[model samples]
Target chain A: MQDNYQQKILGIIGGGQLGRMVIQSAINYNIDIHILDPDENAPCRHICHDFSHGKLTDYDTVYAFGKGCDVITIEIENVNTEALEQLAKEGKKVFPQPEIIRLIQDKREQKQFYKENNIPTADFILTDSKADVLANADFLPAVNKLGKEGYDGRGVQVLKSEEDLDKAFEAPGLLEKLIDFDKEIAVIVSRNEHGELVAFPPVECAFHPTANLVEFLFAPAQISDEIGEEAIKVAKDVIIKLDMIGILAVEMFVTKSGEILVNEIAPRPHNSGHHTIEANFTSQFEQHLRAVMGMPLGNTGLRMPAAMVNLLGEDGFTGDAVVEGMDEAMKEKGIFIHLYGKKITKPFRKMGHVTILEENVEALKAKALKVKDSIKIKA
Target chain B: MQDNYQQKILGIIGGGQLGRMVIQSAINYNIDIHILDPDENAPCRHICHDFSHGKLTDYDTVYAFGKGCDVITIEIENVNTEALEQLAKEGKKVFPQPEIIRLIQDKREQKQFYKENNIPTADFILTDSKADVLANADFLPAVNKLGKEGYDGRGVQVLKSEEDLDKAFEAPGLLEKLIDFDKEIAVIVSRNEHGELVAFPPVECAFHPTANLVEFLFAPAQISDEIGEEAIKVAKDVIIKLDMIGILAVEMFVTKSGEILVNEIAPRPHNSGHHTIEANFTSQFEQHLRAVMGMPLGNTGLRMPAAMVNLLGEDGFTGDAVVEGMDEAMKEKGIFIHLYGKKITKPFRKMGHVTILEENVEALKAKALKVKDSIKIKA
Candidate 1:
């Protein structure tokens, strides 16, 4: 949408659910938006002031799209960083700044950056082929993972035995000894361009044993307050190091003795912070907008005790999505449902999520799980 | 996107911010959504599973759009109800149903329904047209209004004198005598298809002096507790008579001696209830979702004292939109902004709004007005 006036339009690449969410934040802040995504039906399409369907990884497409806005940001990391880098050189504010994105995009380089920056991470060996790690027999128990495009348990395998590596999908992947953890936790922190930073209470994440998808999450994690603080500190450290100008979720493993180790980094609103939409004073969605738009970061205090349970596609139901038990689930008090509006749901596909907020966290958790079990994404 | 799915899909007509909000609610109960709007880029486009772009009043468009959806509901009343009625005969569920919609769509019919049902309203004379209304000049100091397509301060005009009546835009309208009101109030209620009803606390609305837009709204209205209870009773009475399914907002006037008179009815979410997004335990958005999905209504408790301030386009600002004082406003605490992603701004166009949640209501009220004045919506 061209105008004679020059409004500060924020360009977003990738218009999936996260982009849809990010655009909501931008809208709240009255920031003009331009989105570039390959899907004409991308989630952020309607919410943006202007949207163009194009490839995020096509340099020319991305560059041309980026040139139309005052700043460029992304909901997903699999983008053409070279084009973003060029725009950064041309003075457009590209956040997670192209340099930072460059470091995080490749697993090998990301691992090296962690090591060089003295960030705590699982010990890993970068190898050209799966056989390289398999040949080192002692390291056979490690988890083999290709860093790029690995999400929701995809691009990851547990090499419990040497044969597991023989059936691997890719060559160049990271081999890291899986660490035993008492709990998995993640902290979402926001940093503005002026270097001001704020962190929400660390949230404990419980993964579905098989799906490896976050089954449920709790804010101010049901751990020692001290451990939660440590997680927040680790998250802040990561964002400061990256000079991130928006939200970054730092996923970590809590050792049996309560030591915190960074598991991975996501440079946008992470699934871990979804509870904020109902439970926090200023939701993570609104906070991300404030951070990137250079507005003051909002208070990250929890407004009420809350629990979030993922509403995944039920196993064996694939043709279309149907969430049964919602009739009974909605009867439960204080439950808030967030469906992603996906028309079809394959087995274990992310369909939507439910958030239960009440003063009593214990009670809410029980109800949340029932909500999780009751709703079925079946055909 | 076609599949053999038996589950119901709720067809919502109109994709304005209100529809976008209702979409949030529908998603909560794991309900299927298909929106019809003339603008391809209406706010709820990506959020609903499927969207059809066409005029709401076009019979073919409305009928075809409602063909597959199991039930039809409107986010706005300016729809082709005859088509909905036809679809209903073929067994589609149209909530608040087409019968109710037809009655409410015209001012004359609405006033007649209120009188027939013994519901209280301002004294009104329904006119056949502008000529008919002007022909009856015995009623001076009257509120002139067109029955349909009038929203957010449109459709209604005050005819105080011969000059006022002559100067008023001539069309099919009404002449209702103005009342001496102490304050303006609105109550939002949600009812299920089964006719169960839940009423929220009546909210006090302050209007923009010139634009006739709701400038601010505070819930748990300033009236005495007894009056507030009575307000809820009156609202429930109206909904029961209307047999409104899903959410309905009943706007009212509080006369000088404390008499509450019904002002108007909105079948969907109302701007006056915007405070629920921040202050209430279950936002009207979530409640609307619950009502339509047949989910249990959430607890309707206010979490904090809150106020909503609309962000209207500044006069003379055309072509593009920009919000000023956001940086300074952000510096202060407890202010939440919500901007509609409209590409252009015309004078008095509702660009967006802000909801302030504070512990201290008096202090919050003062701050709200300051923040409201500080904002400038100009290109």
Candidate 2:
């Protein structure tokens, strides 16, 4: 029998909602979690075993934090990869390998990697500035995306024609042909150091018109068996190709021509998989912990049909969060609400989410919509 | 819309594993949890929003703690009920009701409550001392229990005959007739202030030979439909009779003669219901939060057949805990491990638990046994 076992300490870079959820799962395994974030009042500050207030991109701060942990991971990708690479070289387990994080940190590199790897994706041309994008007017009706430091809907614009090109970014970016897709979906997959891989079923997503963020997600995406199988295969292939260890969310688009194309990917627990906390045997948070810890991946099977609705801050409201209709929304059965403990709400800020589970997909969808309308996060 | 919404703070009496798990659920709702416990290093010390290192049984400590919270509750029943009663009088919500907690604190009072309410229970006689028990030789083959401060297997002894009377407690206690039980089952019930009640399906429990604590629990107890319904009704009736608000665990014995009797009851989360974390749609922890918060009760439907095995410290081991076979145990599919963040291990101490879910009952039982035998906690 093992004797005098010492528990391993895990260090996370960002202490946002994702880190908060990951710490929730880590508590079950008796693992001590240390979080480093710039915000002193980060969502995970109070819950983690230790919280260090520091910038994630500061090399000295990141290296100092990694020095005290046996395993290092991240909740957000915008971190110092050089420090992580040094830590990995010193034998600390840094998941989603620092190299992969660097590749994903730049949207241009991500697109080029996809093309070089023969992955199915929309055609795109790298651009140095707005002038470069304008010169590619022949590639009109395209989407212009900044190469780095873009998040949510920021640093992105649609150049439907030459006139729309004026909205293009001045910094180095990319112009990709915009395809009219029938639907958007995401698949979350995880891999461990032992080469064990598991993928959750695809979830269809609907974006908010103004916020440009996922508004609703339906698990077991409404697609044929063949399409679902292909999606799973493609997700697995991407992870294997990256040679990465950790959870990766692969967002894809399905065109009217019945073709699937890669859109974007995140190397941590993604919003698209939040419903798994109540609808699947293994939640994405727990799965991420298992993958990074090199434990056996849990069963990623769905327990019930589910729909998730993002609880975003109401427009024109930015102050102490006041959650309305929580009591009324909770009166409905099969509804689980999760607030990020953010205290404050900004317009379109992701405040929390509500997950609805039902035997009938239609019922799940209807309940999800009702929940979205009933609850408002305002000042 | 809710305007200037103020979040409520919840105060808990104990900061052990139960409180830790409760905080895990409370975090999802963004509810601030404050804990009061004498142990400065309690498992919940790190996770709770606020923690006061003080005795739960101390009137002033509990009262002061409750005064700061909008709602107050307990993870253990040995707390100062007078303080809770005072809190309730001052318009604070003290769930499980102080009166009910006081009644269940003493074994004698609990037995009298069952008798007065016409609740089916094994025949028993009140005893004040060892001599009092010896005087009742005619009541041979009974069990003796202390009136108060007795927990786990302590202050309880089986009096198979007059010779066993010497083992009886010298303090005021009770003598209960021994039961030739076919199996032991427990049903957890919850009630909100609105008088809404819900009961989870009965679970069959197997006790450790020496520990006298539940070692294995199987959900959807293998009992007749009539017995299951009867057990559920009895559980609901007890909670309703107490006029209590929150979760109550009712332990019962099913005699070989096809009769069900109430054995004991706990006013908080019990070991018998830990499997619900993964096997049921709504976990007992979350259910308790909802009941006490006066939110709508969640669906307690079973998601899969499940078995839970408590991870007890090895009999001959003590000091820092060392968990062996965790890697092997995790290799099995459908297994969820929960390790209470206890740094030390003592003989028979509850260190953690493993839950196994399977489609087949036999497979679940086999897997549970394998997990129990495979994992070893030592110093």
Candidate 3:
């Protein structure tokens, strides 16, 4: 039988909303896909051409799932790297290859790699003993953060006073001074295997204040061109140093002097680039898969000035997540809502996001604020 | 079992590319779906959560497949209306409802309904016997079209000269004069169950001169405001008259005398509205689902000026299909490519389309022509 569709399958290791969205890109190219995830009802299952319901990290599941595809990719980072490495050794394409995945899986290795590569980062003392920094009275109270899997403010603590120092006893990790900055920002940069790289405009990050998850991202950065160039340069240099072959979203801190410092990196599509779906010519998820597959990247031009507001589960809400006022909220011009289709949600869990695209910055900001207030993810 | 993630299961009767595209919108809301089509590997099969492979016209299949859905709809016009009516009688929610489906299923009934409701359409005479038309002689050299299931230049014929008239001596249907059309345009007007209606920017269409199917659609239709308003009024009137609670694509022809006349109407997403995916604030497919499901209608504002060029298979190709130069065509700024995942090729088969978005009409038109010439669909 002759197979007519020319695009090869892009196998994704996790079938969450990220994978679901990645499949959206694959659909445009008529690319066949095989998805692996634990849930039979995983969001990605809806669109994946072929799906295997199993743990993403199960070595057999990951390896076998990869064998049939021309390239293997991932939506989440928790997949087992050893299994991926074995597959890569057998000539299956795994991007953000197992080699790179290995370097970024552990926070200790990730931070140390940055240090070894002479990348500018906050200086921290890494130790196996959590008591070392606190017991050393000479050591001023500093921030103690776990070197691995620190997500959504979990495993990270701000230690300012003497009394708060006891909290550091729980996480046996590194201690560094918390950088005082004006605003948080992130840049979604794409680098193909051949070294072609392009960066979307930096997005100004606004945290939830309480939840610590990025609540909103304002596009076009609203910063001077000089600062924008500096940010993109920093992101480009990070990609070059990491030898990244796909999209690497570089999150950073902007100092009072408008200097950008590297904060973290995500090998796949990042939440910060969500605005690109409706605001930019090419979405980050599409760019990541294209770059990894050695396919030509799309235009990253801005389609409109936009802002993205994440929808987290409201506190005390758990089952059968409901996006209230969504119908009413979406009536506003330029507002685009994306519900993740997750059934259950713990408090602060990412439920969805709403993007507003318009030309008038002030007017769009006003509407975005209204949309943020009107729409709620609750049971 | 209390279904946590379940919102509503929408069953679509046809599994063609339009149904495949509709699945995309339902995916956005994480809506469960059951698509019934005969092909085992139908393009819409995997994208839909639960798809039962069956023929739409089969009574048992149509009736059973729609039992579990909250509301049932269709992308194709040809289906068993009796089965749908039976389901509706049993309290199943079917949009374009059963009555509307029954009336539109046959050409004779459709023409009668249009005339009774004063809907402007081409003058026609419906006669099954070719002898009746020949005996009349006045209907000779007429535009003879099928009363059912005609699409994309198929099931339609134009009797131009005496040679054509003689061949029509054994034709199956009656005919009428071919009205010289000025400019063809389409209005994607959506109406919810609540009677709320919103019209997308009218799209001006140009035919292939040979294929008869729309070759391109220039959105933000470069016509006078009066003509645009008239198109919207016609579309809205059709929606109201049909009492169709979903999207309706009203195709019209502006005569050489500037008089607008209805050409045809599709009660579901139409090819002429494909440009809305990237150009409009709300895509027609999503809006269709929303409207039929009784959800609040969304904004239909144009995000940018867009032009869509269809991808039709060349006449000589007939095996496995391939589209060349896609990589280079979509690489240009403001160009968005959509592939229908069609494998087989025949003369004038609808393959896919490319939408170019730019504020400058001249620039967009130039890009559209280049896109049309650059990409070739062949077997």
Best by DockQ: 2
Model 2 segments more than 4 A misplaced: A1-6, B1-6
Candidate 1 lDDT score relative to the true structure: 0.79
Instruction: Report the number of the highest-TM-score candidate.
Output: 2
Candidate with maximal lDDT: 2
Q: What is the TM-score of chain B alone in each candidate?
A: 0.93, 0.98, 0.94
TM-score of each: 0.85, 0.97, 0.96
lDDT of 2 at A149: 88
In model 2, state the lDDT of residue A173.
93
The RMSD (Cα, Å) of candidate 1 is 4.6
Fraction of the real A/B interface contacts present in each candidate?
A: 0.44, 0.65, 0.55
**Model 3 interface DockQ:** 0.49
lDDT of 1 at B43: 66
Which lDDT values do the candidates have, in the order given? 0.79, 0.90, 0.81
After superposition, candidate 3 runs with Cα above 4 Å error:
A1-7, A135-141, A169-172, B1-6, B136-141, B167-174
lDDT of 3 by residue, B241-265 (tens): 9988888898888778777788778
Worst 10 residues of 3 chain A by lDDT: A1-10
Query: Which model, 1 or 3, shows the larger lDDT?
Result: 3
Q: Tens-digit lDDT track for model 2 on A1-379?
A: 4521237888999999999999899888888899999998899988998999999999999999999999999988899999999999999999989999999999999999999888889999999998899899999889899999898778878889888978999999999999899999999999999899999999999999867799999998999888888988889989999999999999999888878899999999999999998888889999999999877788898988999999999999999888988877766657888899898899999999999988998888888889998999998
Off by over 4 Å in 1: A1-13, A27-70, A90-92, A122-149, A155-178, A293-296, B1-15, B24-70, B75-84, B90-92, B122-151, B154-179, B255-258, B289-299, B315-319
